[model samples]
Target: MCPRSFTSTSELLSPEPALVEPNAGNSHSLRANRLLQHAIPPPMLPVVDLDPEQVRVLGCLVEKQLTTPQQYPLTLNALVSACNQSSNRDPVVSFSEEAVERAVTGAKARGLARFVHPSHGRSALRYRHELAEVLGLDERQLALLGVLMLRGPQTPGELRSRTERMARLDGLGEVEAELSALAGREEPLVRRLPRSPGQKEDRYAHCLGSAIRHVEDSAPDEVRQRDVPSQSPVPAPSSPAPGAWSEELAELRHEVARLRRDLDELRSQLGA
Candidate 1:
């Protein structure tokens, strides 16, 4: 298959210009896109089922690209630091370069990321995420996904707070609007998790793959301290509602789909 074209990393690193509406001349491109869409079958679309490590790696790439543009295409060491950074990340992890490299390779295979060589006198290869382009996400959508990937499930308010560095989410409404857009995609990328007992808001999580268990535990300590005001401790419920398990079942189905894809790829490789 031909490589998918998207905004180049260099272009992303450049200053943004004024937004303009598409002109009539671009109609040919739109027609081509529609024709290509019909030409490709649903099964031919790449399945996005990133493991937790891959999620963190891709999240770091997206976050760094927007937040630290001067160092957008991160080197291996830099990406490692971003992924393991004590701040911002929930359930802080210490991933080795090898682990990160493997995740990067997985993401590349999924067309969510790519490797690049740094310009100038530098020689080390760098990496950047193509998620925004591949997923057709705007800045707000990318910000929410990045935060969800890094921090795990969160309330809309929490997302708005954390994504401030990456996008301007004026209020919970804007966040919800964008979240709705993401969830409404043909292949949804996000889902709203069931509200826990005593919680006033529903937490949202990315549906790229299996859930990250550590993040499912609770909000980050810093987030709790900063955003969640202290309140009386609420007792844990004995059991969840019967229907609450439906979402979890769906998540398992996603994992199964990913496993099936992997098995198929292996069979193809072995020519079985």
Candidate 2:
């Protein structure tokens, strides 16, 4: 059966279905539980399983809305830029505006996003995500979720650092607390995967999409690409010496400057 489309904001905000575990050996209670499960259907719920492109679109919307409110409800061009950003994204993509629009359309059908036609002197259509309102998430929760959607699974430390621009996650403890809150929801939004080999902390992935599963399955390939040089058969390069960090840092600074310039131009276009 097809999931029902959310017709309005109120519909999207519908309360979560309550699931009570039946008491062991209570036949009557078990019967009632079975009936309740059938009565409260999953198809009518707001949950939508997004593809990778849709996940990226929704994540970009959530990110821009929180980090750049004046530029909230981003134009298609700006959203494409956000989706293709170099920093704060894993497996950075070069999505065309058509691809982004298609993703946004898919998200809108599932009630995760809304599209606004050109209005009141604005000639370009803008897009926004309804996740915060639909899922009852705060800025902190949405920020973390956005990062998980943009990047693949991440540890609490990674989340804390990456979400700094969108939300202030004070420390690892705070990040974990928020993650726990997300995972504890009736329809869990995030899950902790078993820690990978050589990793001290467990990584968390968003449950709204199957992209993470694909990411998990392709882990070896990702590792190979990062660790192996295409032209050489040498083992993975060892960590750079202390002196080499300066060069990496300088490159990062240059990237940040470029990003800032792009952001400034976008802001101007948005009249922010």
Candidate 3:
């Protein structure tokens, strides 16, 4: 036998909406609603769900903004460092070079960054993600945008140097070429900045948009602090210890060696 139970319709029904008097002074509920209205949710990139590393990469970018909002639009290297430095030091959270590159490429493909060529002709690149809407940009172009955003404006040569340190390229010619391409585009991705004193070089800036405002509002105070202009690209990944290439190369070599051994054994067995 089961015991009888009583139920109330009032319990099942939705609760009544809170009544607001004519002039409620700074109510908690009202402030919460205001915050919700202004809050910008994180990007919904596909890679976030499929690739954990990619998610970490995105987290790194967010962390950089939180740490240095003013210094916003972190260079790629800076983003990588932030991820490595995060308090969550689980093995799953580490940022490998392949992971970083794959994440960045995936993000860029999804229109998350504006890349610029390396400043000094290195393969390294710079990028800016000020706008929430990701925009496809190669390394060179991203660097160019970063330089312009931080420094206000500069000529091609100056931008070339700014992006080159990380670009890992050999010359400024590539930067020049990219600038030319941007200029020729029907709807240019970047626009030339107004000339400045003794500024012989041409400068450029990202197009202003509502997205920028959203990012600015959402970003933390520290990020806003370090975001100022500087003489050069900031130093490489300080925390992660910039030797990802060697580790990856070693892994590849080990795989190759294993494959060779397997092939040799298979050949001997066939002969037998």
The candidate maximizing lDDT is 2
Score candidate 2 by lDDT. Answer: 0.83
**Each candidate's lDDT (Cα)?**
0.80, 0.83, 0.51
Give each model a TM-score: 0.63, 0.63, 0.30
Q: Kindly indicate the candidate among 1 and 2 with the higher lDDT.
A: 2
RMSD (Å) of each candidate, 1 decimal = 29.0, 26.3, 31.1
> In model 1, which residue pairs have backbone atoms overlapping below 3 Å?
none
Q: Candidate 2's residue-wise lDDT over 1-272, tens digit each?
A: 23343434456556556666778788888888778768964442345578889999999998888889998899999999999999888879999988998999988866788888889888988998988866778889999999999888999999998999899888999999999999887667898876665789989999887556434666656766766667856698799998899999999999999999999999999999
lDDT per residue for candidate 1 within 1-272, as digits (tens), equals 33233233333334423334446789866777667656743332234767989999999998998898998799999999999999989869999999999999888866688899767977899999988766777889999999999988899999999998898989999999999998876667888776655679998888878554333444455455666677998998878677878888989999999999999999999999
Task: Output the lDDT of residue 30, model 3.
Answer: 77
Off-target runs (Cα >4 Å) in candidate 1 are 1-46, 212-272
Candidate 1 — worst ten consecutive residues by lDDT sum?
A: 3-12
Q: How would you encode candidate 3's per-residue C-alpha lDDT over 107-127 as one tens digit per residue?
A: 555444446566654566765
Q: Worst 10-residue stretch by lDDT in candidate 2?
A: 1-10
